[model samples]
Target: MAEMKTLTAAARSGTGKGAARSVRREGRIPGVIYGGGDAPEPIALDYRELNKLIYAGHFLTTIFELEVDGAKQRVIPRDYQLDPVKDQPLHVDFLRLKAGATLRVDVPVHFINQETCPGIKKGGLLNIVRHSVEMRVPADAIPDAIVADLGKLEINESLHISAVPLPDGCKPTQRDRDFTIASIAPPIAAPEEPGAAAAAAAAGKGGKGAPAAKAAPAAKAAPKPKK
Candidate 1:
């Protein structure tokens, strides 16, 4: 289950870029909350606090309960914009989540027991195809991450979406095919030994089709002057 976080915000009466700029000048981030069958509400959050949360990571997957002017709104962060240069939070969008609502979100995939994987023990490489998967999950039951266990995987073997255990009422977005999540690739070739490589090179140096060194010119006949 996703852990819920709480944020405090204040209603903002103004709208548009100028108003948003004014809010930012005052050290606040302007944002909006919509959906859940209600009119969108404009609000502002403390810049420092919001920045901290944004950088801390996993802001989108976790649910946030926004306390806006004494009314608490349960929402999930859907989108956000950042300054291209500084990477600072510029604007945010939150979707108000009502009870029983379902959300389609990308949940990160976490590989476990990799050190104990049989394939890895045998010098095989683990190739990940999908780092995360899109899931349609209930708002209250969104998983923090999906686990992919590699302990028993063997070389040339693969794990598919159907093998993973998902939260109740959660389903993968890709239902048409059982897609591969990861695979154990064949081991990389070991480097040739220096002595062996040298021996092979020497053998091939004069092998078939190789041009032979030109014979030394025949010694000139002894000068006939003495005769």
Candidate 2:
């Protein structure tokens, strides 16, 4: 189970790109909260606080308690827009949730026991195909991350998304196919052989010397004919 985060927010009286830019200039982030049969409410959050949550990698699935207009509301992050260059949060969309509501969220995957894996010990590379997976879990039962153990995986073996153990009442959105999450592949071998390369260079020089000797004989014959 994951711990819930509490954020303080204030209602925004002004809306529009200009107003949102102004809010950002004031060191705040513009956001909106919608769902639960209510109209969307425009809001602003402290940029510093929001940045901390983003850095913690908890903005997507963590349940948040938003203090809005002197009232506390439960919400989950639905969508977000980021500045391409600076990678800063530009806008955020929050979905209000009722108690006991089940929501679908993408949670990051964490792999364990890499050192104990025989394939990794034998110089195999671990490839992570999917960094996150989607699951339907109760708001309070959302996990911070899904853990997959690779202690017994051999070379060319894989751990699928279905192998991940989910908490009770939580289920993966994927079915009918066991999606590959991670795999161990053999290391790439070096292409060039040092000894073979040296031998080839010597053979090339010997062949060049033979051609030079034949050219010398031809030059001598031409001079004799001129005489």
Candidate 3:
């Protein structure tokens, strides 16, 4: 399960573009918390602290205990925007987690036991179909990642969602089919032998391997009409 993160935020009394700009000028990130049948709350967080979590690469999936004005609220990141030029955080939206609420999250995929996989030993390339899977999980049961084992896979074999062991109360958002996660493909073909290539070229010249019929001797130019 993903570990809960703690973030400190302050309630914002100001709202709108000018207000947000003023907050940013002070090195804070503007954000909001909505859902759970409660009124939306506008807030702001320290830029330095939020930047660290954003760069850690798992901020979206990890649950957070947002401390706002001495009150803690369980929430998960729903969306965020980044500055087009500087790539800095521009705005953020968080969703409040109510008891028994199931959240849909895209969890990263991790592979294991590659060295022992028969396909890898035979030079098969591992082709990943889905690098991450969307899962519907209870707020308290979100997993860190979905692990795919490649130990028993052979060349041309695939690993599907059903083969993976999901955490308790965690289910893939895709329920219609058992989708492929990854596969081991046979090694690419080697270059053709020189002799075989020469033989094929010769055959083409002789018309045996040609794709088109030789033009009928250019149809003897109809005897030029008598001048």
- Top model number, lDDT: 1
For each candidate, the alpha-carbon lDDT, in order, equals 0.94, 0.88, 0.93
Which candidate, 1 or 3, would have the higher lDDT against the true structure?
A: 1
TM-score for candidate 3, residues paired by index: 0.84
Provide TM-scores for the models. Answer: 0.87, 0.80, 0.84
Of candidate 1, the 10-residue stretch with the lowest lDDT total is: 202-211
Ranking by TM-score: 1, 3, 2
Which runs of model 2 end up more than 4 angstroms from their true locations? Answer: 194-227
CA lDDT, candidate 3, residue 180: 99
Clashes of each: 0, 0, 0
Q: Tens digit of lDDT per residue, candidate 2, span 64-157?
A: 9899878999998988888999999999999998977898988788999999999999999999998988888898788888899999999999
Q: TM-score for candidate 1, please give it.
A: 0.87
lDDT of 1 by residue, 118-218 (tens): 99999999999999999999999889899999989999999999999887899998899999999999998989999898778877867544468999999
The residue-by-residue lDDT of candidate 3 on 91-138, one tens digit each, is 999999999999999988999999999998999999999999999999
Clashing pairs in 2: none
Q: Cα miss at 192, model 1 (Å)?
A: 6.1
lDDT of residue 88 for candidate 2: 91
